[model samples]
Each structure stands twice: as structure tokens, then as C-alpha cells.
Target: MFSMFRPPTLNIFSRSSRQKDSPKTDIIPHLTPNRFPKLIIASASKTKTEFSQQQKQSHLSSVKKATANNVENNKGPKADIPTSRSISTFPKKQLSSSPPIPRSTDVQPFKGLAKSPSTGTFNSVARIDNSSNTNPSVRVNFHLKYQTSYGQSIRIVGSHPDLGGWNLRHALDMHWTNNDVWTATIHLPSSNVVEYKYVLVSYDSKGALSWQSGSNAVLAVGEEDTALDVHDSWGNGPGASVSSEGGVATTREFKLQAWAQDMRSYKEVARSAAWEASRKKDELAAARAQIARLKMELGLGSKERTALEERVAALERANLLLRAELAQGKLVLKRTLEEAIKLLSQDALSVEEGE
Candidate 1:
């Protein structure tokens, strides 16, 4: 309770000086206990706005004083952060200009590498770019799943020359779509399945080509569906099994099972397009029927509206006639009452004269 009444003590010297000086004693002047009530009364007498202004002024003054004290104390040289040569020893890392790579664990690896060509083949007129492909059965797309480091690229090499014919120098480089997943789409006219391996190409002057670990991925091109999107993971060699395809796939079933996923993807694409067209057709028919129904209702509504207006006018006219009849009856009753009252008064006067 006594502390609350006491004013706060403020230090005049720098923080460093405070450490060297006496621990408990301050250099501030002490206020007498008798002066505390006077200070409180003076503060209470001041308006709220004046009191706040004083508080802000005191705070700013203290800050300025502390800063001046610090400046005076720091006039000496600062401890050497690093000598000129030592500064270069800790090189600053440059900010990467490329986008941030996605977290590895965020996406599951593309389960199976569909052994499609590093490129695709275009049979017929090559209508993959058309609004709709000319042949859905001949389309196949490849998705390469891998995370690449800065200044490093991904490419594929296979038995075909287009894929560098297993030569690292002739490998077709895969393009990164900023999705951390590099993809290579082939539109070649070949319809044969091919085995391809992912290659890590360094952009340095040496131009090193590192082949992916494990076995090559095999893909059956243009098989079940004309269009397919398959994913491949780095180092996830081929998961080929035998018993799945009546053991015929014992060695091939693994590939076939993985390829089956591609087949369903294309079928789903075709079905969704067909279903969308049918749904739009049905909606058009329903819209036309609705317009016809609205037109009929509008025509009937015009006739009904005319009949309602005529009925309202007739009732209004009948109400006016009834009001006029009531007024005339009231006038007649008023005249009759006045004449009967005069006759009653004359009869009373004649009886009083006879008496």
C-alpha cells in the first residue's frame, strides 16, 4: 500500500553504468512522504487530456535521454565483427530464382513408371492437338515423376533414337511444369511399346548424365485406350509380376496391371465427354418445353386479368347505388319524425285549452 503511494524511481545513467554502480541505491532525488498527497492532488486537478499529454511528454523525454546516454557511451569503436578476409569465408547463399520445390512427402510417388517412349507417336494425320483427337485409341501420354534440384534437369533415354537410343547425349529432356513433377508427352507415329529410363542431366560445363537407379520402365503404347496419362517415380524400378495375367503376366502382369490404370483414365475421359453432351441436349429440350408452357400461361393470365377487372368495376357500381338508396331513406325518415312531433305538440295544446 505504501509503495502504491510512492512515485517511481528513475535512473539517470546508462544501463552499463547501472551494473557498475551500487545495486540498490539510485542517483534519483527522494520525494518526502508529505509531498506525495500534494502530487496526487495536483495530478487529480489536471484535466484528463492534460494528464495524458504529460504522460506522453514524460515518456518521450525519458526515451530521448536514454538514447543520448547510449550514444555518449558507444562513442568508442565497436568490437570487430569480422576482419575483411574472414568476411569472405562465410559466403552468403543466393536466393534461388526458380520457384520453390514441392515437399517430397506431400505427394505419393507415381506408383508405376509406364514404359512409354520418352516421346509419343502420332498415327494417322496426327490430330492430338485437334479439339478432339481423330483417333482416341492411338493416344498415349507419359508422366515422369521426379524431384529435380537447382541447375539440374530430367530427360529420358530409351532404345529409340528419338529417346537418344540409350545414349545419354541423345536423351530427350523432360519439361518441368513447376509441379515438381516433370512430364514428357510423345506424339510420334510409332505404335510399339518401349523401355525408357529417366536421366538426370547437370547443366554444368561438364554436362554429366546420371541414369536412374534400377531397371528400365516398359510401356505398351496405344493399347487399351488411345489416350493415357501415366506416372513414373525415380528409382522405383519396374514392379513387373507374373501370376496376375494367368501367370502369363507373371513377368508381364505387373506392367499390365499398371497399364490397366491408364486404360480406365482414357475411358473415363471419353465417357465424361459423352455424358456432358447428352446432359446439355436434355437441358435444351427441357428449356424449350418450359418456354412453351410459360407462353400458354401468359395468354391465359391476360384473359383472367380482364375478367377480374370487370368484376371489380361491377361491384363498385352496386356499392355506390346502395349508398344513394340509404341516404334517401334517411331523409324521408327525418321529415316524417319532424311532422309527427309538430302534430303531437298541437294536440297537447288543444287539450290544455279545453281543460
Candidate 2:
């Protein structure tokens, strides 16, 4: 009874079960009196490892704290440094009081200008001729009373060069103003009397010259006179009577010729426009014909393509039938060859049996 009640002894260094698991086991299927020592030993080893880790952590914390304390003690000293609040409480220099600048707003006189002249001096200056001239010549206006035709004009001829010096080529043509007046502006010599006459000039195909038949009119200019308006009349002349009728006929004929030319040009432009329109119509018709031909060709091409596709399909079907027939004939020939060989073997066997 004592031996049956005794528990089995355990080997602490046994490797069979421990080696399969590990040198140390964390799990077990069942706990008995024999496993109590292993559980206690595993728990003791865990406590020792935890305690050693806690001591290492505490030592590391102490070393970190000592290094932080040394770094804080090594910072610079703060002797005699002024704080922000104390610096704000100190006194500062004040700005100086200044006077405003002086400025004058009164209107001032022009320093370099001369004063106004007296009444006598003003009267003398006003009496002088104010028209500016570089030579000793007086600007003169020559007005003649005449009604000029369209192709007829009035010209002034005089002893002075400005008045054409009695030369027909250099005669100055006078412009016709209102009220049947022809006026010409000419410069004449001052302090002398000059003679000038009017002539009728006709601008025609004949190019006729007509001169005045009367004595010349005189022009007296003074040194104090800057300009003068001398009015005159057209003198008697052979060309004066025919001036109106000749100019009117010539004017009418020229207008008629110009109208005829315009009509001819309009006719030519109409013909050109008609020709261009006909050409464009021809081109349009040709283009439409070409389009119709191309459409017909395209329709024919589509028909040809469809017919070709159908013929190709038919040919392909014929080729496939030929191939199937050829394969069947080959199978039949192989069977026939096998039958002939069997028949020849049966005849030879019969001959041998008879022998």
C-alpha cells in the first residue's frame, strides 16, 4: 500500500519531451504533482528576467536625468542682463518743435517787359502800313467787270513783269468772282504809275489770240499804301464778241463725245460679263456629266465585287468537297489492302495443312 501511493520521480534534465518543445515549456496538457516544480521553476525564471529588465530601465533613466542636469548647468551666466519690462520703463529723447515754412501767394509783375506806350506814340504806330514786305512793291487788286464763257477766260497785261509785261505768254489769268467780276491780284512798283489792260483768252482747238483795241488803264501806287483795289472794265476787242458762242459750242461737243465713250465702255463690260457667265455654265455642265459618269462606274464596281465574292465562295466549297472525297477514297483503299493480305495468308495456311 505504501508503494502504490508513492508518486513517480521527475528528471529535471530529461531531454525527450523538453527537446521536442524547448529547453523551457510555457504550456502543458495536464498539471500534476510532478509538474509543480517545472511550473515554479518557469515562473521563477520569468520573475528574474522581469526584475533584471526593470533594473536596467531604472539605470538608463538615472543616466538620462544626469546628462540632462549637466547640460542645464553648463548654460551661460545671466548677470547684468536687462529684462523686457525694465527696458520698456526707461526714458527716451523727445522730438523738437518746428515752425512752418513761409510762402508768398501774391501775383507778381513781369520784370523784363516794357510799360505801355502813350496815346501819341500809339497813334503814330497805328498809322503805319502793317502789311510786311521785303521789297519796295505794293500789292494791287485788278478787278474787271465781265461775264466769261466756259472755255473763255480774262487775263491782265501790263508794263510790269507781274502784269505779264505786255507778253501774251506771261499774262496772268484772272479768276471770275460773283456779280460778273474778274479779279486778279498783282504786285506793282511803289511811288509810280503803271499801265495795265485786259485781254480775252479762248481755250479752243483753233487757239486764237485777241488783244484789247483801247488805251491801257493806269495804276498809281504810293509809298504809304500797302495794298490797293483798282477796278476796271474789259476793253473793246475783236475776240470779245465771239467768245460766248464759240465756248458754248465747244463745251457741248466735248460733253457729247465723253457720253459716247461711256456708252461704248458699258457695252464692252456687258459683253464680257455675258462671256464669263457662259463659260461658267459650260464648266458646271461638264462637272455634272463627269460626276454622273463616276457614279455609274462606282455602281458597276460594287456589282463586280459582289459577284466575285460569291464565285470565290462557290470555289471554296468545291475545294472542300474534293478534299473530303479524296480522304474517303484513301480509307477504302486501306481496308481493301488489309483484306487482300488476310486472304493470301489463309491460302498459304490451307496449302501447308494439305501437305
Candidate 3:
């Protein structure tokens, strides 16, 4: 019973006893030199592997950074390559390496001047509005100008499309003012309403013709609206109609018929006059050319006559000198011959006497 129920003993002394046993086992930590060296080598290898892994991680991080930098740099704006459309959109711009051309808005013409029936009269002043964009090259100036006195007369005439009556028309003198405004001085026989339009004579950069303004102006006079008929000299009457009632006229079938007739008459007269003038000018020029040619001929003949006279004088003087020299030579020969004859005769006499 006592053996089986052994009381728990204090093992604190048992551990000390075991440690003190065998001289504390002199348990020189069985650290054999080779084992120690092997342990140290193993530790060193593990440390080297850890260092190599760290180096690999650092190199990988550097490569990732370089890739990131390249991605950022690749995102910059690209170079602008000129396209064909860019060149063709503006040929001049392309040629000059310039920008595109700007468009211009439509411009209106200004109204100017009133007039009376008196010829070559500047009875009224023209007023032009200054509220507009002016042309760059054109400097706008206004002045009272009068048309030159014309030799022709503004006679009234009448005509008829249905039968015959007065159909009038007019022409306006339009010109550019100093301020680049177009001024029109309209002329017509005394009338009420007049309708007209403005026409622009313009050209493009390529010299292509273009019109910028309307061909006709606004409703002008009012006389002809009420006074219209096909009865007069032109209405199958005795004498031809000489006087037109209204100054301006128009028709769909006979559009500007009166104007055309007047223009034809004026043109015929102008052509005849021009022909006569040109013929006279040509005749005058011809006369002048002929006169010049005759003068040149006369001058040449005079010079030739002078040269011939000098030659004739020289020949006459040479002939006279030659005749004198010949006469003198003859006289000397005769004298020498006489002297020789005398000598011969004297010698013969002497010889005979001697014999």
C-alpha cells in the first residue's frame, strides 16, 4: 500500500542532480569544428539567398519604374501632319503658307443728287450716308460735279406698240465718288413715277465678271401710270409723232422699245460721225506723212546737187590746168626743134666749106 501510493517528490533537485552528473557532462556543446563550420556555412548560404532575392526585387522595381515612365512619355501630343484637304482648301494660303481667307458681307450703294431740266445744271446737291463699311482702297469724297455740254439735243419722241403713241425713257449718269460711293444723276423728261435699279460692274480676282447690286432701282416717277394710250401721230396718223408724253416707258412685248429706237438712232449718228472723224484723221496723217517724205526727198536732191556742182567745178578746173600744161609743152617742143634745126644747118654748111 505504501509503495503503490508513492508521494509526489520535488523534482527541482532532480534536474540539478542530472545537470551535475558526469561533471555536468562537460557537454562542450558537441559543437565539433566541422559541424560549427557547416552550420556557419549553412547560415551564410541562407543569408546570401535572402540578399540575392532582395537584389532581384530591387532590379524588378527599377524595371517597373522605367516602364511606367515610358508609358507616361508616350501619351504626349502627336506631331501635326498636313493633310491634302488642308492644302487644297486654300490654294493661295497653301502657296504662301498663310491662313484662310475671310468672307465679305454685302454692301449697299448710296443715293445721290437731284437735277432739273436745264442742261449741264448742278442745281441740287447730293447727299450720301456715311454709315457703311468703306472699301479699303477707295477714299470717299463728295463734290458738285456737272456733266459736260453735249452737242446733241434731248428731243421728245413718241411710239406705239398697239397703234402709236408716246413712250418715253431716260438714261442716268452714274459714276464713282471720291468716297467710293456711286452717284447717279438721272435725266428724264418731266414725269411722275420712275422705277430704276442699280447695277454693279465688278470682277473677281480671276477677272471673272460679276454683279453685286440690283439691275433696277426703286419706283421713281408717277406720271405714266395714268397717262397711257395708243392715239397720236404714232397711232397711224398723218405725220410721224415727234413728241413723247412720258419721259420713261416700258413694255413686256416691246421692252425698252422707245429706248432701243432712240439708242439706235443715236448709235447710227455716232457711228457716222466717228467714221467721218476717223477718215479725216487718217487723211491728215497721210498728208503729214507725204509732206515729210517730200521734204526728205527735196533735202536729198539738194545735197546731191551740191555734190554734183562740186564735182563739175573740180572737173572744169582740172581740164583748164591740163590744157594750159599741154599748150606750154607744145611751145617748148617747137622752140627746141627750131634750135636743133639751126644747129644742123650750121654744121652742114661748115662741113661743106671744109670739104
Q: Per-residue CA lDDT of candidate 1, range 1-355, in tens?
A: 3433433323222433455554222222122344646656676656667756866665555444443444347563222233324434522232233445879887895778545433322121222332333433344344566777788877777765456678776566676776787866554332244567787877553155577775556655434334445566775444432221112322333444444455455445545555555565565556556545765677547676567556555655554555455455455445444534544564476468658
Tens-digit per-residue lDDT, 1-355, candidate 2: 3333322235323433554554222122233356756755554545555645754555455444443343347552222323334444422221113333546745576688443332111111112222553447656666678886788776777776656578766666677779988876666555444556777887442233566555455444544456656555565321221112113312222332343444445455555555555565565556556555765677547776567556556655655555555555555445444534553464476467658
Measure candidate 1: CA RMSD: 39.6
For each candidate, give its TM-score against the true structure. Answer: 0.29, 0.28, 0.18
Candidate 2: pairs in clash: none
Between candidates 1 and 3, the one scoring higher on lDDT is: 1
**Candidate number of the best TM-score:** 1
Better of 1 and 2 by TM-score: 1
- Of candidates 2 and 1, the better by lDDT: 1
| lDDT tens readout by residue for model 3, 118-214 | 4322221122212342311111111122221222211121121110122222222234345333343322231112222222222121121222221
The TM-score, computed over Cα atoms with residue i paired to residue i, of candidate 1 is 0.29
Tell me the deviation in Å of residue 169 in model 1.
2.0
Q: Candidate 3 has what TM-score? A: 0.18
